[model samples]
Target: MFTLAIVGRPNVGKSTLFNRLVGKRLALVDDQPGVTRDLREGAARLGDLKFTVIDTAGLEEATDDSLQGRMRRLTERAVDMADAALFVIDARMGVTPSDQIFADILRRKGHPVLLAANKAEGRAGEAGMFEAYGLGLGDVIGLSAEHGEGMADLAAALRPLIEAKPEDPEEEAEADVEIDEDDLGEEADWAPTVRRPLKIAVVGRPNAGKSTLINQIIGDDRLLTGPEAGITRDSIALNFEWGGVPTRLFDTAGMRKRAKITEKLEKLSVSDGLRAVKFAEVIVILLDTDIPFEQQDLRIADLAEREGRAVVVAVNKWDLEENRQEKLAMLKEQFERLLPQLRGAPLVTVSAKTGRGMDRLQEAILRAHATWNRRIPTAALNRWLMGMLEQHPPPAPQGKRIKMRYITQVKTRPPGFVVMCSHPDLVPESYSRYLVNGLRVDFDMPGTPIRLHLRGQSDANPYKNKKRAEPSRLRKHLSGRKPD
Candidate 1:
């Protein structure tokens, strides 16, 4: 697919344009300049044309190792990777000196440049639109990415460029092939034609090396990383293949305590990270060895469990730890004590900087994912429930025996079960915990959230609530005469 990178100075609505084209709010957009700190890629569709669009960080003049400087380098890297660059300018503010400088930079790069005069919806933007032509990149296309104006002109300009590239023969052949049902084997019924990628979200407190861990996993400096906390603002999702399994990894902003989050942008970042957790099938909670399992870390892990996502606790920066054995033991003890809900979850020690223990982490993640999607047969479930009831029956509440009837798995993906009983409401919380623990042990389901629902049988008669019909006087007299 043809790849286009949206490049511009701070607060030029590059992310807005990217979101508009992608038809999803994948990137975080705020009025604050430099809200974007990493390069975000999305499958964008304009009219009938489909291509990959990259939303890059705002280009800055900083050349040193500051945060802005890092952002600049990452954006430049995007420009190099993209087939073409869509240079966006704020028409409402007119062309600034910074825009001119960036235009020169793009010219030096020698890629196809498409000048977009964004926010050109009203008369006030006309002067800036006219000023944009002076940059001499090419004919300026005036469009409002926010209001969806001038997209036709933008698409018209891009069609020739996108179509000029030849299609891959292999892709074309694969697209043309049709599957025959008769030729499929038994396994084909259960297997998916297109394997879905596993979604994993890496979350933790500020400066926990979440970005660094993802970069190491992808073996690319795809994310912006530094000593700075909260370097990542948006929850960026990247698709890649790991250990022959297709996966999508989300690098989220660090979540701090609610009282500490005073800035509006940080709040947005935190909320975005939370949304990633909800969407993820597996959540890898990255922790710093220096201060592992902080209150915030526990909160993050608990949240993932509550959200019913498979949890994997990863301790990062192990390369710097001298007392590995002692630290690992303490970490295990603490993990079991603090987060018992995620009991038996994988606790992996890794070094995101040096690429250590990543293999173990990957295995743990796959295992957790399998366990999350595990399902047991109804017969097996009922047998297990019988054994559980025999070993430790439910308590008699108010002199009434709560008969534990049977259990059946209703769904997978965290494995939800519904238990039909006489009085489900009277079941104690401790008894439920006992059953949940037994499931984790007997069924070999660990680290995955187990949802147990207790249900009572409804009344057998459907018309039990309806009033009974009155007997007619003639029918009563006939019955009395027969008896006589």
Candidate 2:
């Protein structure tokens, strides 16, 4: 597919246009300038043309090692990789010196450029639209990305560029194959012959090197990283193959305590990170070794567990820790004591800066993902439940024994089970924990959240609450003529 990078100064509706082309709100949009700090890619469709679109950080004028300078470098890198550049300008504000500077940069790069005057919905922007030609890029295409205006003209301009690229033979071959309806049924025990990318989200408090870790994994400084905390404001996802397994890794913004998150942008960033966690199949809670297992760290890990995501605890910056053995032992002890919910989850020590112990981290992630999707047979579950019952029976509350009839796995992906019992309401929380722990140990499912629900006999029998009908007259006559 053809790749296009949207680039311009801040708040020019670049992300809005990207979202419009992609037909979803994948990127965060706000009135705030420079809300986007990382590169975001999406499969975009415009009429008959299909391509990959990249939403890049706003091109800043800074050339030194400031945050804005790093953002500019990242955007320029995206332009270098993409086949074409979509240079966007705010039609209402007219073309500024910053816009002219970036246009010159794009021209020097020698890539195809498509000039768009966004927010050009009405006569209010007509003057600014005319002013855009002074930048000397090309014919300026006026369109409103927010209200879906002038898309036809935009499509006409893009069709030539998109169609000029040669098509991939593999993509064409795959497109020609037919899919079977029967294989897509709910009851079908189907598995993908082609491996899909595992989605992994790296999350922790700010300045934990989340972006640095991702950049190291991809072997490119694709994300903006510095000594500054909360430099990453978006949950940027990148696709890459690791250890022969395809993966989509998300680099999220740092989360802080709710009270400390007073700024609206920080709140948005944190919420976006949380959404990444929910979307990910496996979560890596990246912790700083210097301040390991803080209150926020515990909350983040616990949140992942409650979200039923397979988790891997990674202590970063190990190169700085001189007492490696003692620190590792102490971290393990703290992990077990603090977050017992993820008891057997992998705790890997890595230095994102030095790229040490990355192999172990990758292996642990794959293992956790496999555990999350693990399933057990119903017969095995029932047998295991019987053994558990024989060892330590359920408590009898108020002189009524809570009979556990059987157990069966209802689902996977953080395996869920249903246990039929005589009185589910009376079962104590401690017993549920016992059964869950047993399942985890016996079935070799570790770290992934296990959902065990107890169902009473009354819950299964629908007619238990239905009122019985009165005796009929014929039954009374047969019993010897009873009067009404």
Candidate 3:
């Protein structure tokens, strides 16, 4: 897909337009300036044209060593990577010196640049829209991203540049694969030739160093981090490679207790974090070494378990702690006591600041993911079930023995199973827990959610023993008459 990069100075609504084009609220939007510090990309469509659109941090004039300078460099990289760039200016404010500077930079790049005068809802922005023409990037197209006005004009401007670009050979090959499914055998299960990137979300309470850990893992200061709590508002996802495996890591806003979140913006940030958790295949619940296993940390871990995501616990800021071995032991004990749902889950210690124990953390994440995706054969499952029944028979309810006939795995990815029984309703919750624990231990599936469902075997017992009696013979017998 042709890539379009949206760029502008701070608070020009670049992210809002990006979200509008992509038709997803993947990027966090706020009235606050510089809410977006990282470059985020998504698939975008306009009429018949489709492309990958990137939302970049607002450009600012700062020294190369400053944080704003780093942001500028990242935005410049996006501009270079894009087939065309949307140079957005706040029409209500007119083109400022920063906009002119970025415009000159874009002009030197010699790529197609579409000058966009954003937030031009009505007559209020007419004079500024006229002023935008002075920037000399190109003809300015007035549009309101929030209200989605003037998209047709933007599309008309982009159509030519996008269509002029050549199609990628790799994309053509992917198209072939999609259409050539018939050539491949019609096996119900068709594994991909390429490995998809593992989606992992790093989450915890405010100031747990979630972003710091992700920055350490990816080996980049791609995210904006500071000592202040709640520095991160958006759930930023960045691509990464660990141990030769492709990965997508989501750095989310630190979740606070609901009662404490009085501001509307904080609520949105928390909601965004929850969305990341839902989309993640694996979750790393980071804990501050100073405050390991706090109430909020336990709540976040429990949420991940309820979501059925493979979980790994990470203790951050390990470098500050004294008596490493003793602290680790105490952390483990607290982990087992407080969050039994995640009992036996991997708990690795690391200093995201100093880069300690990252190797072990990566290994643990891979192991948890593998365990979550594990599938057991039906024969083995039934054999294990039989052994469990023999070891401790299900309790007799009301002096009637509850018979469990068979067990079969219905699915994997947090493995689920169904048990055929005489009365599924009679199966007690304690017995279900027993079976789930047994499966976890026997299958070596630690820290992953296990689902066990009891189902009654289908049967109409009255017709099983004999043929159906005729109604005519029954009527004659009731009248005391002999039937021929």
Candidate 4:
């Protein structure tokens, strides 16, 4: 989708307009100034025209090192990535020096810029709307993003920009791949190369260098990064190729403990990160080597496992650590004990700043994803089930032996299965775990979620046709026959 960035000074209803256009409340909105600090992108629709809409932090004048200055740089990055920009201003407040500064910056960028005089509901904003003509960008669209007014004009302004975007070759190629019947019967235990972009999400705690790692991987500062904690306030997804493989990586906000999260905005940020984790096929849990495996980190890993997503643990900032061999061993040991659900998952050490050990991390991610998508044939699965039963039979609870009948794989993408048993409810949870582990080790399926469902076979009545032979006790007593 074509990217459109909404840029303006603070408190000009940028977020309001963004939510209205995206048809969702993605960006946090408040009456307070600078409510939005990070670049937020959403899929927007104006009438039939569809494009990606980015809500950037309010432009401000500050040094490069200051927080506001970093935010401005992030907004600049958004503008560079966008196909066009919507320069918004409050009609009630008229033009300010900040507005003019940003307008000049937009003009120099040479991208199509649409000046929108926002909050112009009635004649009260008429004078200021007309005053927008002095900005020299283009004709001003008197819009009320809050009331949905002037949307037709806004749509008209966007039509040309949307139509002018050049067609992407990658998209064209994806659309042109023709499916043939011969391709469907190629192989049974076959795995094809990942032709589509691999969706990956890098996640960890606050200040764990999530964005920095991604920026290093892309070989550019595509995402805003600094030493400040919680700098990333949204789940920002960027597309680039890694070692000839097309990939889309999402840099999400750092997650904090639930009890520690008090602010509403932080809560939203955490939710967004979780959503990214769910959306991704593979999740990289970036751990700061200085403070590895905090409680929150363990929780994050567990969440990924429960979500049935492939997980890879990467210990970052290895350059600063001493005794590399010793630290690596300890990290492996810690990973096993803390997150057994993700046991045997990849644990690679890397330095996002120096770009060390990143190649290993990428390989681990691909391996885990392949394993997560693995499927076992039904005959092989049943044969493995028989071997497992012969090795260690299920324990009988309350002297009622649980009979294991047959097993078959029901689906892939985590390799789920259904075991028909005599008493499925009697199957113990420990037995289920044992089967899961055996499946992992036996089939070489490691670091992927496995599901085992037990179902009991129904018994048919034996006395349905022989009613006289199976006479009721009451009938016998009433007929004066012997109860025995």
Model 4 lDDT, residue 149, Cα: 96
Candidate lDDT (C-alpha), each: 0.89, 0.88, 0.85, 0.85
Question: What are the RMSDs of all candidates, in order?
Answer: 5.3, 4.6, 5.2, 6.9
Off by over 4 Å in 4: 1-3, 24-30, 35-44, 48-52, 80-83, 160-195, 459-484
- After superposition, the stretches of candidate 2 with alpha carbons farther than 4 Å from their true spots are 176-193, 458-484
Best-to-worst TM-score order: 1, 2, 4, 3
Candidate 3 residue-wise lDDT, 1-484, digit = tens: 7889999988999999988987766787888788877777776788887777889989888856566776788788889989989999998998788888889999999998999999999898998899999988768899999999999999999998888888877776665453212111111111223676687999999888988888889898777676668867777767667778877788899998898999878888899889889868999999999988888888899899988899999999999998999998899899999999887899999999999999999999999999999989989988998999999999989886788888999887788899998768888999999999998888999999888889987545767889777669879899898987
**For candidate 1, lDDT tens digit of each residue in 1-484?**
6899999999999999998998877788999999999988877889999788999999999988999999999999999999999999999999999999999999999999999999999898999999999999999999999899999999998999999978977655665444222110101111123676788999999899999999999999999999988899988877788988977788899999999999888898999899889878999999999999999999999999998999999999999999999999999999999999999999999999999999999999999999999989999999999999999989999887787678999998889999998778889999999999999999999879999999997545889889989667788787784432
Provide TM-scores for the models.
0.91, 0.91, 0.85, 0.86
Query: In model 4, how many backbone clashes occur?
Result: 0
Is 1 or 4 the stronger prediction by TM-score? 1
Error of 3 at 215 (Å): 2.7
What is the per-residue lDDT of model 2 for residues 1-484, given as tens digits with 9 covering 90 to 100? 6899999999999999988988877788999999998888877778888778999999999999999998989899999999999999999999898888889999999999999999998898999899999988889999999999978898898899988999988666665544221111111111222665688999999999999999999998888899999999888777777887877788999999999999888888888889888878999999999999999999999999998999999999999999999999999899889999999999999999999999999999989999999989999989999999999999999998888988988888889999999989999999999999999999998888999999988535788889999879998788897858
Worst 10 residues of 1 by lDDT: 182-191
Model 1: residue 292 alpha-carbon error in angstroms: 1.1
lDDT of 4 at 123: 81
- Backbone clashes in model 2, listed as residue pairs: none
**Whole-structure CA lDDT of model 4:** 0.85
